[model samples]
Target: MRKFISRAAALLLAGVMTAAVAGCGKNSDSEAKDTAKKWTELDQTQITEAMGLGWNLGNQLEASSGGLPSETCWGNPEITKELIDTIKAQGFKTVRIPVSYLDMIGDGPDYKIDTDWLDRVQEVVDYVVNNDMFAIVNMHGDGYYTVDHSWLLCAEDDDKQTEIKDKYGKVWTQIADRFKDYDQHLIFESMNEEFNNDYGKPDEKAYDNINAYNQIFVDSVRATGSNNEKRWLLLPGWNTNIEYTAGDDYNFKIPTDKGCKADGKRIMISVHYYDPFNFTIDENKTAKTQWGKYAVKNYDNWGQEDYVDSQMALLNEKFVSQGYPVVIGEFGAQDKTEKFADYNEFRRYWSEYLIKAAKKNGVVCVYWDNGYNGNKGFGIINRFDYTITQPDLIAGMMRAINSTDDYEIPSPAGYTEVRKSAKAS
Candidate 1:
């Protein structure tokens, strides 16, 4: 399900201004910007392929329910090296750490991020990259939450554009400077899913504003010097929605970066997928509990393998083929609901098929996990034990990714081939 505001709350904040003043300043030392590019340089395509399977460390650092900035505020244990090591051991090559700076930054002209908070975030990034896994640090849940007075909402308003741009630039400047010496494996995502009713729709002004913000992000990071000059950056579309992002109506454009132009492609497009809401994310008691070609009941007519093929094909044609790699930053089917009996097998099929389709289309997908081990939670790893809770799901994903047999590539018109099995059915 989409994070941030409830549908009702979103409607209420449609026209409201919840802006809070923020102060900004350069807090990192000159030593932090030392010239050192550690990781081997790879183009965006190679980087995307290298990422393989990924998982999100969600509902922890992004939690702000109790007005606290600590990871434990949401009931998840403090992030530890063992947890990241376990993720690497489970075959996940990339870890996307979503963080919220709502309570970590000081209040308008100067929004300075707390040094300790920046240090804590760096520690987590180190845990992932130091373990040889790709890490993505993004500003998550920092936008569109009415209660938090999101600056992202201001990005869409013409009146507040200057203020929002200033804040956005300051935030990225701090982040880029702090991690200036980190290698290419540590990617900086400009924002999470920043969108609202009008801004998320097919509004030209909104698209223009979003593009401007992305430009600010790229310019700010590039200005930090050192490794950031050619660092990989991920830019999200409206609400990170695949349809809205890849569709013809959004007028989405990749921001230009002079620093990355000479080094080859350094910008990647990001989108989220949880299609067929009735099957993947709908929490209603009457929601469809089963899906896939082999399902005997509750099978969704849409969002089948063919649907996956078409959406992926759209991305490949629109961006991947044009030199920009695509990252499905968040995608998953929840298994915490009791509404479905014997749901694990069906969920496994979904995982395998999605990974296979994404691979065929040259896209990288990262599963979203909110660390809930109980009802409606998306946790796959047991945080308490630092172990994988669902072995079958992980095995299914690995098998799909490791399979050597190639499925026929689908055309823009439609999919025309049947999937072949390389393992026991």
Candidate 2:
């Protein structure tokens, strides 16, 4: 029988599973764990600073069709160590690998993840970690309503809570154990962009369920012991929206980590930035192509430089200032070169300024690359040949990452004071 199955039976018979045995797995590689933890005796700030700029291995491992996941399902080639090697060479110290189990997970109490799929994911993570880069593994598309067999639903009926929570615990239990021996370089993020589908005021019950999911994620991973006990975890708020996460209207709770010897010093808050969707993802509406304060035409009056400043500042005040580091897990604008003549220039400018803003506020930013190049895509490098498709854009971003001087945004063409009301606070 699987370890989780026996543990579940025991929990039912004993009425509860104690915290002491949550990480009741084997630690065959204790020596490695000790060495990895000892390699860096730094707090969250120093650790995050060491991470530098991050990039997402997006639309590949997270790709699914009819609920079945395949790395090539989304038209991207199989993930190669060479691809990660090139990424590391490009000055990215961290790689965020978004994943989804969906049909890859089994039914019932244990909810065993498919060994083949899990192993493949591990192989990719090793490619990054072995390259001396931080690897962030996360539960990616399991919560999306569009994905088939996605049971990690926060908006489901209350009667389904037991099954949902059980599966959640079992999934993370298996994942944590699989990578329990890994060092601090392997970070496990709770979930990606999860929340009630409602874009308006979030549902209270759904938000509460998200909190429960995060708590369960932390508890399950820590229970697995080994390096997981001290591993840095990335937790996302509702939809990973800056306003919803940090604003006073919605309550986003950080999970309690009694398992960590250093209180919650190992935890990091995650949020995404794609403000002014009109210019970021909405490629069909090409009128809002230009961005930043210096755009002469086709620009959004809101979500400009000031908007980015306000959002990053909110995260710094709420979390970063209080010990928890913030990660902008995914942020990038789609290619609009076909629509606008100098779209690439504006896009490069957007990335440069955003990196500077994140650096200014002491937040880590990861570019979202969906692995597709050309118009209407968020890709920066071609996954097939492992070449940098956006040379100027990537170069400017790297400069911003390493530069010591503050990158100041020039004032708008006709503006004096800032537009506070339109900003996303």
Candidate 3:
């Protein structure tokens, strides 16, 4: 499971980060000021294909407590360029860095991002782009659960909505300005998962506000000019859910980019897939451990291969078919390797099949690695050692990505009961 550091502990850590967090100096002069040089000539389809298989540097930069951001606050070591080099060596073509700028952001009207935090983020992005790989930097966790003055609330009180929008736009403006000169290799995602904090049916007003946020994000980034005017932007639907995003019910409008230099090809859709949460996450559940048709025991009856196909088809019909490429921003089954001896085998199967499905439907898939390497965790690589913890799973996924053969679902085997004590959350 992911670590949510206590506010007290975060406060203690914050004491050391005071200098870095408190400084709101002007942007550095090291940026490449050339806005005319074109880095990528690929259109949306080619750009999506270029992304290939992607990885998330999760739970690191996005880890925060009491509004203070710390890369190591959640038990992960400091991020090193070597860590990113290891990831690139493993065949990942893109790296998505989930970032949070809570207390790292100065008080409004400017909402200036702390200079140190912004530079640190740029340093990581450089690690990825230096390897000639696509890097996605996004506003993550600031829109998440109630904490750290998390203000990206789409369903804010009517009176407070202006403050939220103002903060959102100002923050994006600073982020865009900081990376304005970076090439097309650097992409900006509007927000991680901005919703009403409701898991039920989405609120129309909330959905409308999310659209407004996207528009603000697009306008704000474009206003920065430079390479950002044409930089590919990823937009998430309600909570980044496939159905809420592309399905008929919710309101998810793509932001209008009137002067986007990419010929209307700069916008991309972002959504996550964690269907049957009981299997992918929930540690309290004991039954849905193994997944897929061949799993004779401890598998979800639904969200099998057919469900994967249908969901991909939905995105293709609604988005991809119309020129907007859909990205499975996050998707993975957790490690229950200790709980079930054959768990990794099923994980390999799940990964392979999911990759095949995503590729078939013209979607890019980025695996979510939360940096934990045991039961209930979604890590595949040991971040500190830069070692592959789940070789078979990673291998299966790569094979699926490269394979052109038609994928066939395996026949279901007889069920076998396997139950374990639920771990306390």
Candidate 4:
């Protein structure tokens, strides 16, 4: 859910939109009847298994400098039916669409969402649903939910909590209403990774607020109509971190929806994985650039297969086994430094191992692709032409889910040859 935009550009956009009203203009008067057929009611586990291999339409709708800019502002092509069709062709069964409603929403009590933005979002969603793929639409990066401006941060202040709850409720109410007609193919994610406190550590009160917000989301959506009553909803853990979320200390609780007549059968927990940050995200060369059995130098000491197994095990034991499912909504290792001889090979291994481990534990895995194809970005596909730019990585993912065999640890040819030559010298 993260993207880069220069400070100057953000300031300029804010200044331009300052004179305009905050809402997305006005809600449309045309109340389209629910023509879409409702999907068969399935529990969380069935939904997760059916979701198969998933990919994120990242850095597009979620890309906003300040105001709601075009999806192309981040240099990604406008999302089209073909793009989703290509994804389906590539063996993906689910698409996670990340969106930001910060600029698209008005101020205060109503916090009205712009109808134009809603229409735009729905149009993109239709492309996914029409193709017979599961689609997830989430509240991506928004300033109001951050640590500095977060309403969830003020745990001691009751009045502040009420105000935050009110605004949060309004936002979801509008969103739920807009997508109410869509069947189970379209899922609503409560929010992206937004949990943070002033102290930068887990706060009990902040966690409480998060639970409240999730409850509000569930309640609001279900009240819209029966279409949403059984809709599969994804709720994220604090910061969407696996350890923090599944940890014994976090006191994470799934919100109960009195309106949901099925008794919380459709709710699923979401947690992200970018474990061994040194290898997955760190830009420094001092960190591990190589991993797996063939890793020549600076191999990651942590985040090996066992690490993945342990985390997945925790989720399965805590949630999945109990009937609630889990989704690894965002997980990827960046190809920031391609100069390494076995970079692509290492990426393939990483992708295969993660997917294999996730599925083994009955968790749905979704890879995060932000559409930046060079250094410091996780771009696998050339979104402009709808082509697979990283075939090895894509192939590895396909092999992992399709193959019945467990993922074998890879030994890169370059790494082995380099070691052999050095020993001979």
Candidate 5:
């Protein structure tokens, strides 16, 4: 277990503010900015290969939840050495740490990310780099759920936007300055799930609003100094989902303010593949879909090369072919009641369709899973804590990504630390 850390909330200008929950500044000793500068040295090809078969370390962040987490929850005891080794052994080169900077914010719910929370977040990231794994740490559900990237949503007035931009500057300025020590392997995704919060509300703007906001996000992430100059950034389209991003009119032009560039080749475009969200998120009892039914276990759905081909056809035409690399940032259907399907089928197809396609094309895939719920065959295994699971799906995808399997990870090697240590020893 890693040493526990604390966090505080930084104050801000309400909806438009770039606020950090107030408290002492976080520990920046290890992740120096000078080191962060090295990221620019990495070109697009290196970024793409390193990102192939990336893994999403979910549930630790609460960006949409409005705050940050107590430092401890940011990994430490939760992430065992075995887990790290398993991911590495499976051929995954990157781990995307989804973080909510609000969970540990403020004294209560006044909205502040505790400073300790930041420290802990950094610690888990360190664990990834320490283990020889590339790490992609970024704002997560927190920025979407409670707050929903308020500034991007344009919740506040014009003046508020400027104020919030400054706040955004302060928030990332601190983060970049702190984690700057890590190598290019330690990447930073600008925002998570940049969707429209007011879909049908009184003040709903057209989807075009999301495009505008994305531009703002990119510009903001860049202004934080050279640390982010050429750092590989994952720029999610306005909604971060495929349908909208691939739409004809909603072109998310790469940002081009003074410092930004065109082609966005260095930046990977993120498009989540939960197309059948009802299937992935809803358990038959609620928003259920075919996901809980036969789609998961059978591998039949996954094996359907046609479905895979079609989806990628559309994706490549709409986005990938445009020159930017893509990533299935999130994908998984829930295994639940009413919607309950055989776990076997669920895993087979879901994995096949998502990971297989990601490999065939130039895209990277991230299975959306947390160390919760045992039935979620999607858990890589049936374990809730995510501590024990199979890496079959991960390995298969890795095989697809690399094309030629010069290095194949054996099954027995993925089980546990004891087994891994035994093998290595």
Candidate 6:
């Protein structure tokens, strides 16, 4: 009985000690988490910087383990014959795959992303580099993930932010190891659209976050122990908007790490153009409203050559002049146009303007054409028949890429209603 009593007393003492330590470590209501914890992926720095010919294939968002090929949505994969033929067939030598990695990884700080998901994503990237194309992959629409993590940057407690940094490290480690052996053509963008304005911190704080995030990304991918050491890296300015990075009001300081400076501008500053802005990006994404973006039958003096050129001039100054190649990573029309003729006409015009502007200013242009689930142009190829829309454009792109000289660029008005009507079905 006496021995039992002594054991009970020891157990009570141990409980008391545990509670004290936990209490001492407790964060104050106003204290934020810290970034003090270190991980290997947060330390390495293997990178490639260069002027790259690239395009972003939109609506290709996916979970880690790739899916069975959506007609226009994420998954499916970018390696099918149709995709390869279309991409390689075009003059494009590089492809940017923007992916959302949330569902694939749990919300936990040390979540282990599913390996199968990682493998599938890698396979598509392999196909791109293998074909002699520079492949740019990035964290797509991940703003949602960070938004939920506001505590990391906005919480009253510093300790929470540190924990958030820990989460970032864990996520990148999984990404880096997956594509470690890929070629230099395979570049990893740190993140897509670092938009967190609610933190109430100065814009500089956001910039600092970008630097820290890129460091983790570079360090994580380099740990894969292969050619990733020299693989190209892309740094986005704010939200990948041309106006944001290239406008007079926008001035983003580029980031460098571990004695590395920004690569004589090899880092491509990505931008998305859907000019006459409202027509292009309405949050109300319905087929009818989507078509509205292309319904402009009248362009007053503002849509004239001078005005368009003026806008593009800003882009050139901000990016091209900086010696860094820029890419219109995405641009496309939603199906808001009431008439198919309007759709085709607007498409043709938009395509012509965007393409020439890109070429003229020495930027690469890629359309965001994902018309999945009955939407238009999600996938260039008709999944059932395996045929492609805009065959002429793809064909022309190839010719341009291979030709010794520049081709005569066409205007949007020239395509006419016949082609639109013919291809309408």
TM-score of each: 0.86, 0.88, 0.89, 0.86, 0.70, 0.67
| Residue 301 in model 6: lDDT | 20
In the range 317-381, model 1's lDDT, one tens digit per residue, is 99999988898888877773487656766677777888888888889989888776544556789
Tell me the deviation in Å of residue 96 in model 3: 0.5
Which model, 1 or 5, shows the larger TM-score?
A: 1
Worst 10 residues of 1 by lDDT: 15-24
As a whole number from 0 to 100, the lDDT of residue 271 in candidate 4 is 85
lDDT values of the candidates? 0.73, 0.78, 0.78, 0.73, 0.52, 0.49
| TM-score of structure candidate 1 | 0.86
Candidate 3 least-lDDT 10 residues:
1-10
| Cα error of candidate 5 at position 286, Å | 8.5
Clashing pairs in 4: 24-114
For candidate 4, give the lDDT of residue 248.
84
Clash pairs, candidate 3, are: none
lDDT of 3: 0.78
Q: What CA root-mean-square deviation does each model show from the true structure?
A: 7.0, 10.1, 6.2, 5.8, 10.7, 16.8
Candidate 1 yields a Cα-based lDDT of: 0.73
After TM-score superposition, the amount by which residue 189's alpha carbon in candidate 2 deviates from its true location, in angstroms, is 0.4
Query: Could you give me the TM-score of model 4 versus the true structure?
Result: 0.86
Question: Could you tell me how far off, in angstroms, the CA of residue 117 lies in candidate 3 after the best superposition?
Answer: 0.6
For model 5, the local distance difference test gives 0.52
